[model samples]
Target: MGEMSDTGRLVLLGAPLGNSADASARFREVLATADVVAAEDTRRLTRLARDLDVTVPGRIISYFEGNEERRTPELVDVLAAGYLVALVTDGGMPSVSDPGYRLVRAALDAGVPVTAAPGPSAVTTALALSGLPSDRFCFEGFLPRTPAARRSRLRALAAEARTLVLFEAPHRIGAALADLAAAFGPDRPAALCRELTKTYEEVVRRPLGELARWAAEEEPRGEITLVVGGAPEVAAERPDDDTLRAAVAAREAAGLTRRDAITEVAAEFGLRRREVYTVVHA
Candidate 1:
């Protein structure tokens, strides 16, 4: 294990999403010698270290969602003192929709060197294995849990053109898929990747309706990542100039700022902002 680097550094280590073999060699070295190993769960980290047969020589601290705000400042102080700090979560990359963002931000403010030890990531893995469009996609993380909130959120994203990736729990999978089908159309192509890269892994690819039906029978174990096809592109509309202007006017009347109203109207009419603003304002 090497001593802390002269320069204060923040290393974001990507722990194995699953399977110890997926862990990068650099990850092992960093865990062995970093001045501080801040993990989401120290117990889990210890188990992982044992799994890889690597000893973590540094102080192991818990840095999870509940305590991230309180722990960040202290970790920043350590980093400022030229200590090497490694951030790891229970799985995959740190700070990618995880609890490492707070520490990363603190390190950035302290001018600590920030780097990543990339390894397995469920987001990209699910996308790649889903047979969906990978060239362009978006990560929406987890949707709202409440039915009303989730439905509204889904409706807002219903017209999204790029493929969407989401993380959801096993218990909520049924409702989530039902909401997706209702909002984005039952026929939308999608893949439900459960326990990716682990034993008992399953990928169900079909219409959202089919996935919902499958989930109704039995819930899969482990983490779940959903990849849904984007909304189909509709042809451009050629509404009359008066109708466009009226739409913007209506939005403004409904308490939207001029800029905000224009954005909403532009999407509705499938017109560019510049085009909508020019036509509406003119």
Candidate 2:
């Protein structure tokens, strides 16, 4: 709380997920200089400061999911008053699947400048170690806890062509993997990153079915991030109409109904089922 600057700004500081060494110099400087530090967990922030050997001289306030709605306005007022405010979470960046979204939106709406001291992120770390296609990917965060809802969500992403990144709890990892395998097909490749940046860090890469079976045997501990490969790319040269019709006929001869045969063939070649249906009927 030294001499306050004329203009205040909301600073989103990314805290390390596990390793203290991952904390950035900019993060330390901000912690020491900011007029106020709003943390998702005040206790965790205290420990992080101690580990980094940095002292936070300003007022430290708790800002987490439970109180984010009520606390956002208060922090926004600090920013409006020309006092620098830093927001940190228990681990990684704020608002990636955590608190800080409401506060950021409020700050932007209030016309207070918002910036970030970006540091280690579980999402990117997991993706980089995933060994899957990284050029294009999407972060799905956490899936629904309930089985039906979770399966429905996975089914919705069944046709997603970009690599998918998700966060899951250790307790639900097995069930989640099972749902993923069922929705995305058992052979889909995936990587499970556990305890990223920590001493006990581990990454398990395998087909979704295998991973599901492995998780059932033993539950993994620590923060978990999942990186799943996209649906297999469709061949650039689509099969001819005769080939499509023959494929559907093969399935139909194997005991599937004509409609089901078309659906299966369409999925196999990444074509629209309706298109396959038309070709088969023609």
Candidate 3:
């Protein structure tokens, strides 16, 4: 039996995405035993510690996106010094559309053993509560800010048949919903979840167009996740070239280049570029 090498040990501690009670046994054990805790937000970590009634023995350091570049060496140095290092994001799993990725890479590069403390996640939470298909789904983390860029992205994903999950900010919820309605069709079935496990948690299901309208008027609040139904099953008969051309034209109007538009249309029609190009140019 041998002690785990410090140089190769990295624990990815999952924090509660919401409701504090969701913290798991493994999470508490890791927090209690790890020699160093790299937190996205030290203050939040402190609060979570208070909620869990756990006192951490090691030093807690800030390691967020803004300071990730500068903090990597420091974290890596600590791990190299033979200390058990644990990485935690403000919520949910670290490095998942969060700030723990760089440190994870650094530790792995140094041959550090990495593991996780599974806990709550808004992505899965939304999907489970979405009232949509759970068998298959994809997570499309926060869409771009610019309307044009956002629409282009949605257009690209429009053909995705599996359920789709997305994160969005409160301020941009209305615009994002509007764009989804446009790209996926106003009638697409979807759910808008807000605040998750927090006190203000809310989940609303409706057509994308109506959700957009509600978001426009109601001013949504809290951490939002949107789960949308996949594209309707297309009939065996191929949609006419005219339909494909129209879709390409719609995405083009939303700012995607002709090249990108063609790709989007081809995906939607399950056609190859050469196939779509021939139809579009015909």
Q: Best lDDT goes to which candidate? A: 2
lDDT of 1 by residue, 30-85 (tens): 99889899999999999999999998888999999999999999999888878888
**Cα displacement (Å) at residue 253, model 1:** 18
For candidate 2, the TM-score is 0.84
Candidate RMSDs in Å, in order, are 4.7, 7.4, 7.9
lDDT of 3 by residue, 201-236 (tens): 999999999999999999998888999999988776
For candidate 1, give the lDDT.
0.90
What's model 1's lDDT at 190?
98
Backbone clash numbers for all candidates listed: 0, 0, 3
lDDT of 2 at 183: 94
- My TM-score estimates for the predictions, one after another, are 0.84, 0.84, 0.82
lDDT of 3 at 59: 78
Q: 143-214, model 2: which lDDT tens digit per residue?
A: 999999999999999999999999999999999999999999999999999999999999999999999999
True-vs-predicted CA distance for residue 35, candidate 3, Å: 1.2
lDDT for each candidate structure: 0.90, 0.93, 0.88
CA lDDT, candidate 2, residue 25: 98
